[model samples]
Target chain A: MAKVAAELKYSAEHEWISTDGSGPSVVGVSAVAAEALGDIVYVDLPEVGSTVTAGETCGEIESTKSVSDLYSPVTGEVTEINDGAVGDPALINSDPYGAGWLFKVTVESEGPLLSAQEYAEVNGGEL
Target chain B: MTENYTALYEEHKKLGASFTDFGGWQMPLKYSSELAEHHAVRKAAGLFDLSHMGEVWVTGLEAGALLDYALVGKLSAIADGKAKYSLICNADGGVIDDLIVYRFGDEKYLVVPNAGNAPTVAVALAERAVAFNAKVEDASAITSLIAVQGPKAEAILLKLTAEAQHALVTDLKYYAFNELTVAGHDVILARTGYTGEDGFELFVPNDGAASLWASVAEAGAEFGIVPCGLASRDSLRLEAGMPLYGNELSLERSPFDAGLGGVVALKSKEGDFVGRAALEAVKEAGSQRKLVGLKGLGRRAGRGHYPVLKDGAVVGEVTSGQPSPTLGYPVAMAYVDVEHAELGTALDIDLRGKAEPFEVVALPFYKRQK
Candidate 1:
């Protein structure tokens, strides 16, 4: 099982959102979700200027066996994206919470979201 | 989903592996990242419990003759301690399943088939063997398979049994096997593997598999041996340019269409086999499309059934795709028009709605280092 940092916020879809407000909250797939998907090779993230609603699919993260939806954890404007994560998606598989951060988003209006433990309770299996 | 679980289900959880329900089994997909597990098999060694795969035994004098008529390959020529790769096809020459036939003796052979298609393959072999005097018995419940692969495989395998080092694992060549005693149990040790590495796939009785597993882990510790799962299994097999039965080769596509013409013995029509006429006709006419390898020029990876286009026109379909850990590039397998199947031929793949540039290349994308 992966160690979940309590400082970060989470969503029902198992995405982690860290809102230190350096610019926008850095969003990434949770370690639980990344492990489930296997070795990620490709990440499809929205453009920096794109606006997305919470619960909407922003892009996709594809692994060797399947492709899964990368949902927006909060309604926001895309501020920055992780190019390294895009180039080698397995970075997400290795360190999903840290360097494997997918993109950053400026929280639009504090839409639907959950704390790390709350999200863990919803979809948490063995891990 | 209430999927069937493996004997090592708890052990996998203890290892902190990611789980995926494949077929009917809740199997471990990987212990770490797919790339990491894949690299382990190429660089060191990876352990795999392939107990889900089915095994059947054919006994009696007619077993050889029966298998000779049931499969595309000649079973009569297979000597003891040897194995052959074969396919059981439909009357239309479509593959039912790809299997390994182990000639255990003159009148006995063990047929191993894909787990999902075990029942189907067994039924076909039994139906075809009635006239040739063979009996097919599903031995899946009695046997367990463990595929231990990569460069350090032989060294690790040599430690399983004190006697195995000198007689079985060390001296056996590729495709050759030996019947030996392990932990006081009779077993078939084969120098065969799916990862295109120097490895062995051991067939042990069901009861002793757990002991064998624990002992192998203990034996392989120094070589950086890691227990691998189905996730790396797929990537490793893909790197070896091997095809999955459902994805690359299927009932909808004939062997000719899947670039498996090399295995079809059309010239040796001495014995009547399934789909002989259809395979012969296919051989004469030539395949319209052939399975080939495709490498993307950029980061885009083409996945299974995605369309491959040429000049905005669909010319082929991608059968499998992944960023190869060994090659450090996106590689895929596709069935394209034979004219465009040559290496270095430029092509395009449909990335959702957009067209991405790709090129036909020779497989496999990664080769094991000796």
Candidate 2:
């Protein structure tokens, strides 16, 4: 089972949001999503300054086996994108929480989020 | 329906392999990173469990004649211990399945078909052999196939066999097999692979599969033999420009359309064969669409069923494609209009909704040093 950070809040779509709730919150795919995706080769991230809606697809994540949609955990403006993850998508597989953070979002309004224990129960991850 | 499991399923599970449903079987998709497995096959070696492939035995004095009439290849001409790549076609010349027929002796032959098409191919072969003095036996359930493929394949096998049989293992010709004792188990070792590398495929009974696999893995540890799954197998074969049954070769298209006209023996064989007239007519009329290779000029890859276009007009469709792990570029095989199938022709593949620039190239995108 993949590790679910108890410190972060998760969306049903598998995105993890840093719960600082101040300024721009860091966002990345949960470890469960990264492990399920296998080796990610390409990441199409939402452009900076673009407004994204929670629970909607903002970009795509392509792996060798298949492609998946990257959904937004909370409605917000994309404050900054991770160019490093875009250049080397494997980082998302190796470090889903640290260097592999997808983007920073300026939270406008929050969407329904789950606690780490709830997410682990829902998605078969380990808290 | 419940999925079937190979004899080595427990072993794959023990190795932490991710599973996928393939052709009604619970097969391993990957153990770890697909890219790592792909590179292992290219740089060192990779072991694969191919027990899902169907193996049908044809025997009797008329076996050669039965196969000659049933398939597109002249099976009677192939020498003993040699394998010939052939295809079984419907009466209308549509490919039912591509096969590898190995002639073991004068009255014995084994036909290996893709996993999904195995049952159909077995039934068709049995039905086709009714008139001839031959019998078809579907032995897929009782058999297990293991393949060791890469540059160091021979060395790995050499470590398992006795010293006396070392020369036999090294001297085995491509597309040829011999009954050899490997790791104290009797297996038919064949020098053939789909990865476009020098490799050996061993056909052993199901009872001995797990033991054989363990022995090979242990012997190959020093040589860097990783357990490969279907994911790496797909990318590797795609880079080699090999066609997948459901993707490239299908009942909707004939062999001629796939640029495999050579496998269809019309003038050389002396007797009538299945789909002879239709394939002859197809040959005379020529195919409207030809299978060609595509090299992506951009970073994004074109996947299966994507539309191939020329100047905003649809010209073809991609059958199998991915970012090549060996070539480090996107490679694809597609059936395109004959005019757009020429080498060096610039084309575009619709990646989702966007058009990605591609160019028509030769069939294989990568080749080994040997």
Candidate 3:
């Protein structure tokens, strides 16, 4: 089981969205996803200014076991990419909810996001 | 489909190991962290439950001759208590399975094959044994294998053995075995391992596995030994440049292509063996593809089935690869066109659609100091 932040909204695909009620929202993989991935070795991020659709794959995450696509949880223009996470992949495993945010997208259309309790249930259970 | 479990399955579950399906067996993927387990093997010691590996017993007066005819290596000449790495090849010279033949006596040998290939290897050996006086017995069901590996492996192992068997543990050379009793149970202590470190593989009965693990774990406690899983074993083998059966070796390629031709004892042996003619042709004409080592230029590691490119054209494919814990960079084993297999050659591994730069380095990116 992994910790789910009550303030963050999560997707079934395991992306967490931290939104301040509009504008740009920071997105990253949830702690549940990061823990399952084991030591993340590389993160391929979508370029800034690129258009991303909700529920679509925008990038990839490579771990020792295998590579997985990083699905976008909202449809918007990629305003910023986390070079820090890209430079150090282990950050995703160490601080998934904080410094490990993948990218930031400008406000646009988005899909249904689950609450902390719902996301915890969706990912097996809370730790 | 339900996957089979090893004798140590309960032990792994008790240790909170995350599970993965490997070669039809429900195995531990990681007990804690793969990197931690890998580093433990390199610095101190690590325990591995290899009960999934297949063990076939070849007994009778013609056992040696049967192995010589079935496998690529000449096993008949191996002295007692010695082991030789060999390969079982189809008549077409394609490798069926790469195995280690341990000669227990003049008429008794144990052929250990990878978990998934064990049944096939056993059937193949039994088929070849029809012409000889040997009996091939699949003893995998009742046997258990545990490996203790690292720099402190010997000292830790010796602490659990009886005083009289202390010399055997200390004097055992690489690739040698000494059968003896330890912790009140019979065990075949083999000085061999997959990790690029000094290690010992203890082969014991299935019922004795738990006790053996307990005793070894207690003795290795001072050495900081951790129970490792297949993930660490895979990364460790990749750093050592060892070929995994499903990855680096397959029926699509011959032993020569994998750079394992040295193990084929064609020059030292006489008489026809399985795949003798096809292997001879390959030996004479030379292999079209060669396995080479690759060092990644960036954080991204090349994975199996990724295309290997040279000058914008595809020349080969990566077989086995991973981010090496010991070296801190990614390393890979790949089969490339013979022309592109030279050392220090600039090449690219296509990760998804992008080509990542790499260089062909020497095999075995890491080797332990003697």
Q: In model 2, which regions exceed 4 Å deviation?
A: none
Model 3 CAPRI rating: medium
lDDT of 2 by residue, A21-80 (tens): 668999999989998888898999999999999999999998886778999999989999
Q: Model 2, retained fraction of real contacts?
A: 0.64
What DockQ would candidate 2 receive versus the native complex? 0.77
lDDT of 3 by residue, A47-126 (tens): 99999999999999988878899999999999999999999988898899888999999858888888888998878757
Candidate 3 lDDT for residue A93 = 88
Q: Which wins on DockQ, candidate 2 or candidate 3?
A: 2
Number of clashing residue pairs in every model? 0, 0, 0
Chain A: TM-score in each model:
0.90, 0.96, 0.94
Candidate lDDT (C-alpha), each? 0.83, 0.93, 0.92
List the DockQ of the predictions in order: 0.66, 0.77, 0.75
Q: What is the lDDT of candidate 2?
A: 0.93
Among all candidates shown, the one with the greatest TM-score: 2
TM-score of each: 0.93, 0.98, 0.96
In candidate 2, list every pair of residues with a backbone clash. Answer: none
TM-score, A chain, model 3 = 0.94
